[model samples]
Target: MKTVILVALLLLLFPIPVLGGESGLVISSYSVNPSTLFPGDTGKLVVTVTNTGTRSAEIREAVLYGNGLKVLSPGYSKLGTLTSGGSVDLTFVISGMKEGVYYPTLVVRGNDSTLQYPILVTVDSTEPEVLLDTGILYVNEVNRINFTIINPRSGDLTSIKVRPIVDGNVYPEYLYFDRISGGSSAKGVFYLYTTKPVETVQFSLQFNNGENVRYTNTTAPINSLPSREIQISLEKYPNEVLRYDTVVFSGNITNLRQDTIYSLIMSIEGDGIVSSRDVVLPALSSMDSVPFTIRVTPISSGTKHLTLTYMYSDVLGKIYTGSTDLYIQVPDKDVLSLNGVEIKKDGIELNIIGDVSNLGNYEVKGVTVSVLASDSEESYFIGALAPSDFNSFDINIPVKENTSTITISIQFVTGVGQLITIQQNLPVKEKPVLKEPEIPKKYYILIGLISVLVLVVVGYSWKRAMQ
Candidate 1:
């Protein structure tokens, strides 16, 4: 009875082999050649079928079906027989229509059994399209290379590197983008300078597709123009100014091109002067000109330099910056002066005659003149004088012995009503003495008495002779 029970347990555990072919068919393994496909990208799906049972399996046909996936080749693979523990590979070339996850089914029909399996496929379909927006690139200067990257599909791109390569070295050679979603765009810039000229350059785009890296290159021609495109000229009123005087600065801005410039902005800056200021302009058309003016007062005397910066953009979103310089000279302030002077000298006396005039653009009031000689001083009063007008003045100065020079000071109030003193030096010379015949102090009285006596004698002698 124990032996019978052991036989029955063995029979239950392991079933006896069938007389006809005992077969089993299963999908052992499947793989995607590239594992991922971009939209319109072609790839292959490989399915491996195996007979796992003890007998051989005959496969009549196998078919793959999915949505948005077009099979390049015939959709089925035929296999005559699959031996026991043997595997067969079925390849299906397919192209993806758009980006998304897809689940494909693989059905295998055999003589003994039928099997259905699910296959996983991913269509990345996200491609990066890079473009250069800058039109000109100059050497030995900070030239901006503007670029844009666009993702056109519905999938996301990751680990993107945009690199600019040229004949010479480029500053900030590359830019990185961690992740870019579908239907999105990003902008970047690279600054480059070269000692020599370069004609062409290449920009490379690198990004990750699943587990692989992809590279794409684009070539562009460099078209550089002169940096100073806008014509600017500065005009200063009273080009030569005096210290502490207010001056007017004027200028004109003209467009030198035949195209329209948008968002035109200008700024003014100077050294040792006021802070920066900006000028607003709406637009600039071809051959257009605009005038501007500013007033400034200088405390010290010297040359002043001004810089005008112009920033504008073109229709294609290209930016251009240019600059121009202006110079102004400042002179020292002038004092009141005397013109058309005449001097006459006599014995211990001097005469001075001159015209007092205002040469500058200022009024002078309370005018007075003083003469100092031999430590003695004298003053003369004159009235107010207007600009470009003159007045005459005369003065008699007394000089002492050994006095060779005299000082003349003129006092007045300036245009701004400020007290001022102006002075001039006048030379002095003494008149020489003349020598005459010497005569006694009483000679005129003695001569008169002699003449009277002679007259009486003559009359008495005449009377005696008549008697």
Candidate 2:
């Protein structure tokens, strides 16, 4: 009986080991309400530690560790003494964690060993929304896209970046958000100017929590602008004249846009000549033509090219240029004239003389003299004459008794069919003899005979009278 009592007492003193909660500390229930939370969102974790052991266990403190995550509850409760089954409930609130899945470790310290529990916290962020004023902007025009960032959480947002994607390339300029007082929203403006028209533009908004949101829009088609149309025409004083002093250059312009053109410049350019002018043309329709004129003084003789350039504007306040070309001809000046003529006779030689003058600005070539007889069928040709000089030629004529009157015609002929004519008359007469013709012999003899007969008869009569 003593051995049985001793064995029973010893077996009662040493208890058998149990699988759970030998130290009188147990986690009855634990849960985290909303395991996933965003930045600036409030969340809660509930933990129940129970004492199920036979002896009492002193609870020291509980701690949680993670960046920007903290425990709301402070100090560990001391359940100084507990019977077989006893429990304590603990609650914790955490705030201010970025977007990510995080493992938060909760440590419970006791007199024996430290216990750690990993709590999973998931942070989800909302993407921002962006709005654009115009999806398509014309060249050299302003592009303004508005942005709105909505934050549903309770914390203040720090920095935000907006990037524009053009043709699959990121634009280097970043847009920033403006602070909103007493609100969880941010508004920003993105202004851009482009010289080239874009087909599509995409924008991305990045928050401080490393979350990105993208938006895209298509631009509208750009309208055609107003441009200058220049038409050139050439006018002259006499159309058939090979040479002229001045030529008139006429141009027409049509402004196809609704806006008036200011300081519209027109220029004419050609070989060795240039002219320009500026004028203002009111807004005119495509059918309306505005006329403009410029005087062109010819410098030399040849074909001259005339180019016209004009400027105009479009509806979008853009400028355009147009040009046209034309041609003109200038003739040369004249420089030759004809002078008088003279006639002289030496024995049987007939000499003709004339004068020539240089009436032109330039020298003359291939000058000659031609003579035609009025009484006979004979013609004569003279040699070339120098400029501003006179030439004479002696022509021998075969004289016949039947040739009573001689008509002399003189002409100064240039090789190019320019001729001058002069005519004169010459009379023919007989030559005088040196000695007197012999007197008639019959008359002289008769006179002598008569005188002798008279003398004889007078002598015979006197003798007879005397006897």
Instruction: Identify the leading candidate in terms of lDDT.
Output: 1
Clash tally for model 2: 3
TM-score of 2: 0.31
**Model 2: how far is 229 from its true place, Å?**
14
lDDT of 2 by residue, 1-467 (tens): 45644553443344222223357565556655544455666667676766667777666776676544655555454535434577677677766457765556566666674555555555666444444544444344334445455555433444555676553222246776643222367665555445555665566655443221223232322232222233444343333112213344655665433333444666666774333244456555544567877644444456766676667554334566777666766555322233444444445444445444444222224444344443333445544544444444444454444544565554544322334354555554434456888889998999999999999999999999999
How high a TM-score does candidate 1 get?
A: 0.42
Candidate 1: segments with Cα more than 4 A from true spot: 1-115, 118-127, 137-144, 152-154, 166-173, 182-184, 191-201, 229-232, 236-336, 340-402, 408-424, 428-467
Every candidate's lDDT: 0.69, 0.51
Residue pairs with backbone atoms closer than 3 Å in model 1 (clashes): 39-125
For residues 1-467, what per-residue lDDT tens digits would candidate 1 score against the true structure? Answer: 45644653453344322224358677766767556677666777887777779878888888887755777767555678888989888998877778876667677877756666656667874457777788776544446678788877555567889888886556687899997776788888877655467777687988765435678777767875543356777774565644433345568878765455678887656663332246667788767999865544444467878676788875444677888776656665443467877667776777877887766444558888878777777777887877668787888877775678888888876543446676789776454457797688699889989999999999999999999
What value does the lDDT take at residue 446 in candidate 1?
A: 95
**Residue range with the least summed lDDT across 10 consecutive positions in model 1:** 12-21
